[model samples]
Target: MSFSTNQARIRCTQLAPRIGDGPGNLAQIETELASAASDGIDLLVLPELATSGYSLTPSEARDAALPADSPVFARWQAILGEHTSAVIGFCEHGGEDPSGVLIYNSAVILTPGSAPTIYRKLHLWDTEKSIFTPGSDVPPVVDTPFGKLGTVICYDLEFPEMPRSLALRGADVIAVPTNWPYISRPENEHAPEVVHAMAAARASGVAIACCDRSGEERGTVWTEGTTVVGTDGWVTGEMAASGRYDAAVELAGDRRRISPRNDVFGDRRPEFYEL
Candidate 1:
């Protein structure tokens, strides 16, 4: 699953549909996909909870969830087949549980395949902890036209362990789909989300493609930046305000390859912390 030296270009969007606004969501997604397709992007990453706006109550969220074989999947599948490989977010159900239907903050990898492989969000946000079940399995780095890629949704980006784990398993790019809120208070002055992502990019030594939701959804104002951070911890591409997802980044395979002499993950000292 090695990446080629040839450059691979990726495009993404920071969608902002009104809370529980499904029609607007579909329209926006279709428009973005059409634009990305016209631009000839290899991969297109989108925001988390993209279909159903971020402020939905648990019940509203559940009701807005779509089936895996729904019409939306067919449309997106066609879009991917014609335009580009995409990572789309939607609430997914993983069969019935005694407690109730288990919902996951999931992202589906849409490519030319039997079907999209749904990767459930492992790290849950505060209220999200109560809404979705935490995933236990480690995601595998799948081979895409660009390179070996993997995903982590929203809060997963905050955990150092998440991207590190993916890098250790040999992922060239870590794609994150988020609904991050804008925090401008004095105590949390800096852009915490961007700072955290940069730190993760350096620690993991893999490129990070983070697409976040923008604009006002319900009452929550999100930090509307869709960014790309290279392995060197530099902001390669950014759309940091309430705007469209118009960032493109070229990742070099030669740059991502690690030297045999250097041990990045093998030397980690994890014994200090107990899970």
Candidate 2:
């Protein structure tokens, strides 16, 4: 289907990233970039730490971390098409900070004719605390020709405050690069990670796109949970474990009211309750 200028064509990739294999991982990212252009995708979101892989040892994380101006980023910038924007995950070096880990698990947003934007993971998972530092900055709601774009990493979406604030700040679409792993669940149900994403999308009246990886890293298996949720809380498109999934999402900033009398934001009673 053809997308109008107001509609955003988004794609997510589910692929296994080899741990500490920078060159191999970069090659995979290059292929995906070409694929995104071929698919005519407007926004492409890749899995968390996709360029460096997850489940790395502390030393491995340090070895994989790269400066913000690394040649790999320059390469990605060079290959991106005019209208396409991409979000990819990597380990970032924290130049002279004395507190916290010297590395951060971060995502870089690549826009056609602009400098890249960086977002560090605020909510650290399992062994990640030992390997990277937590971010303290508020994730930005970027303004682009395509839409009001926001982004958060895997665990960050679990907190309603994250998406709610982004939506309140005029973000109509949020991109998530996750590393969801297998956990105990019912025989035929979706992963909890996806459930959280859907709920966030519907509650905030925003489009949410996620990219999750496949295959095991350091004996830890991933859920391969790739999905896109519309503002209505229902999923648009997703592939099983490998491949690209596309969705034409409508991010209407003016459609927040449930009815003529009830506004999604106007009904808020934040003064009565406190965080």
Candidate 3:
């Protein structure tokens, strides 16, 4: 497929959200949004549950949950520049009744002067099942001035089909809001989750920005693996001393073409393989 060549400055801000501290977390996010706007970032990605933090109990999750129409989103929108957009994860109050309240691990894409486009996390991690309801809808690909941005949560990236599906749907960049738990790995090796992200980017010929969280929560340490992978499947950005990963990547153009005669998507033989 052909695409117009466009450049975008992307930043992944790794934050340390305090568990259950909604006010404080919002303040931190607001500050970052202002800074991103000032820095001329076209796409800013934030860690999952950035507003409520990870490691929350059921009641804590509910307490931190915000409706999709929360005024805080508008506040965030006001802070963003005309060319800057952000994707942030938060606990969502899906619904409530006499039986119980539904909560979701959700991410919202905020564009200046536009309604927020929210995506609930379809795949929950190990303990997340106990607190959040898995999303039932497919991820959304939103059109922006920079490019078509696709949204996915942390664990959702583990499913190779997720990024592939987004690419098939014409996504230019995939913004992943993740909170990766620290896992042991061989020295000098990328974290397993980052490896999965890299492979996904290469296989789909799409750029991917994964924003991982920092700091420990409830005795669990974070990998702090915030990274950006280019269309060619190479690590283009890593966390800097400021705890942010920044990169200027191609948001447009025919990245699927690998060789003069070979195109990554064009060479697929789906008819013979059963997924």
What tens-digit string does per-residue lDDT give for candidate 1 at 1-275? Answer: 23344544576687776666788888888777777677777677888988887776878878778766677877876766653677878777666788997777888877655467678888888888877878777765777766778898988888878887888787878888888888775664436776777888777677788888878866788877677787767777545343544444446544543576654565567898675
TM-score of 3: 0.96
The 0-to-1 C-alpha lDDT of every candidate, in the order given, reads 0.74, 0.84, 0.90
For model 3, give the 10-residue run with minimal summed lDDT: 1-10
List, residue by residue over 1-275, the lDDT tens digit for candidate 2: 46766678889988788987988998999998888877778888999999889988888888888888887787887777777788898889877565644799899988787788889989999888888889988997777668788999999988889988888898888999999988889978779988888888877788899888888888888887789998878899656334787788876655677687977788888899778
- Best model per lDDT: 3
What lDDT tens digits, residue by residue, belong to model 3 across residues 166-267? 998998899999999999999999999889989999998899999999999889999999999988888996567888889888754778887899888899
Output the lDDT of residue 117, model 3. 92
C-alpha RMSD between model 1 and the true structure: 3.7
Q: How many clashes show up per model? A: 0, 0, 0
Positional deviation of residue 227's Cα in model 1 after best superposition, in angstroms: 1.4
Clashing pairs in 1: none
The pairs that clash in candidate 2 are none
Best-performing candidate as measured by TM-score? 3
Off by over 4 Å in 1: 1-5, 185-190, 240-242, 246-250, 254-275
